[model samples]
Target: MTSTAIPSAPRRSTFAQPIMAGLVTALVGYTSSFAVVLTGLRAVGATDAQAASGLFALTIALAICAVGLAWFTKRPITTAWSTPGAALLAGAAAVNFGWNEAVGAFIMTGVLIAATGAIPWLGRTLAAIPVPLAQAMLAGVLLKLCLAPFVALSTIPLHVAPVIVVWLLFLRFSPRWAVPAAMAAALGIAGFSMGRADAAGVMGQLLPSLEFTAPAFSLAAFTAITLPLFVVTMASQNVPGVAVLASFNYETPWRASMLATGLGSSAAAFLGGHAINLAAISAALAAGDEAGEDRSRRWIAAVSSGGFYILLGLASAAITALATASPEGLLEAAAGLALLATLGSSASSALSDPSSRMSSLVAFLIAGSGLSFAGIGGAFWALVAGLTLRLLIERKRH
Candidate 1:
């Protein structure tokens, strides 16, 4: 008899990791942007049911954008419900214009995104931004998730703290599977901590459901919402989105990606979703060795994510109900665990480069400080600070 050594299994990225990241990040994004989207929805006389439909629209659009972009680029490009864009639209459209105007503004931003992609000058200008600056922006965008685990710890000790410890240790050891593994562990603990998740509604609530909402458009809404949405989606989201792909050595066609983002945003807008843009943090997971280096094969992950998003969209009501039922700390812990790798990568992206070290440090500090001005997010401010510092340093060297 010939003895054969057992072969170790090669890994493919799991549904849980990406899904957890998606779900958790979406939760964060929604919380951040809902005020705006909600105000706009209510201003336009949207019912709670109609608002739910908007969420479904957002999820569906995100799924398609992520799938399409990832398929075209062989990078794990994800499309998200744009948090910053929502904030802009909220302030602009809340009372001044209705849904029609909001949709019109959405359409305009999409046009702008598309036009910029189509135009060589603008595309090239955006492309010319330093990779480090882009990475710093990426880091700034993810700052909230990084701190969430600890935040959960103070509130839900029986659940969040132990799981966080396990997650941190696993990350130090396993790196790739750490997040999913730790999260799995946490949910098990949550069952115990929550003291009757069955009674509290964990199992029954996982079932999916559907919702629908009709659309109405106006010019006033467009005027109020357009500028702000454009700024956040482009500056806070895509700038770093492209950079995250670059940081992982995946090639990104800046113009093509921007075009895709524009198209996706428009597509989502029609469905009542907020502006959709390339995902900054989670893309790292799907693009990494975890998702497989063979670009042809990588589409599987994106395709899977798209399918999952659609499913989430279909079951938007069910998802909302489930999330609403869960303990806030438990959700926070899961999100924190999922983001640990992305957070580490973002930190390293800024710190690893000697030439841009000081600039990146300044960028991280400014962004992580939670400063906001003129409705511009930390990512934009961080980039400005980094660029300014880099320019000054260069001048001194010269």
Candidate 2:
């Protein structure tokens, strides 16, 4: 008589692979853009406590979205705060009503973004923004930050040279680590130049304090902060982010993803974070082969990254202190190095279509000009200028 054999269960995949990938992705994402966020917050008049709260809120929001979306969609749907929007804020002077107004504008922008996902026409209208015009506007917003490396070299050659050299070397060999390495080197230089005592003040409020500034909305805040921010976040950050996921053959639920980020952004804005959207640069880190050979399992990588981001949020006090401790030029230098590749790609895309050259150039120039009228920034004007030029050219041809 033969005995029946018992069936064995399948073994589960190890968590190490995806967890490592997630750790790397989280590191790259935060190191590359946190400085820019801090700079933007300061520029918009957020106080030390407020900035820390914003950072804390932004990190936690992104963590939740990244994990929740990846779990539900089974796609490596990584989320991020808007780097371009932060840079745009960094360029603009504080609004007349200050950070409270800015926070109100942030809330409004989040609502509009959420509406885009819920309302078909709004989403399509934003999607229909000319590719050249969007690229030009992003390039224009980045131009000033991209120039920081050169400025650093000229002004603080002794302190900045080492960071530049290390960045260049890594950029050639290990492109992924280049920006973080450079940022570390810059902070090191700054630490040596300015003692720990001076830097300690940034950590004065070590415990994360949620300073709730009741948002006061107005036309000026809407025009200056909300519109420009929403446009760039959608056009530059979210659009390319979708493309990145598609490159990996993930059919991302675009509307759902936008809804997730919009909700996250709205929550974060309550504490002073500018905006959070889909990540552009770090998306590949979590979605690509580097995350794992088995594409089906890569979603775990995003989930892991989200877990780490939550940890980072817990340490916001220390991180903000370090950012505040560093010299302004050091931060600028790091931001410039981080954005150099993006600026090049954006410029190329903006000028790629010959037929749209004039309009694209107009957009780029207006955005780069840093002109503000009636509290509206050059970014909005840039789009208007480009669209008007295109319309005029069409009329003349007809």
Best by TM-score: 2
Q: Please list all clashing residue pairs in model 2, or write none if there are none.
A: none
Candidate 1 C-alpha error for residue 304, in Å:
5.4
Question: For model 2, what is the alpha-carbon lDDT of residue 370?
Answer: 86
Alpha-carbon lDDT of model 1: 0.59
Q: What is the lDDT of residue 221 in candidate 1?
A: 45
lDDT of 1 by residue, 181-223 (tens): 6655654664554546443554554543334324455544443
Model 2 spans with C-alpha error above 4 angstroms: 1-12, 94-97, 202-207, 394-398
TM-score of every candidate relative to the true structure: 0.60, 0.93
The Cα local distance difference test for each model comes to: 0.59, 0.85
75-120 per-residue lDDT for model 2 (tens digits): 9999998888988887777345589889988998888888888999
After superposition, candidate 1 runs with Cα above 4 Å error: 1-55, 66-112, 165-177, 181-257, 269-305, 374-377
> RMSD for each model, in Å, please?
8.2, 2.9
- List pairs with backbone clashes in candidate 1: 100-217, 100-218, 101-218, 101-221, 101-222
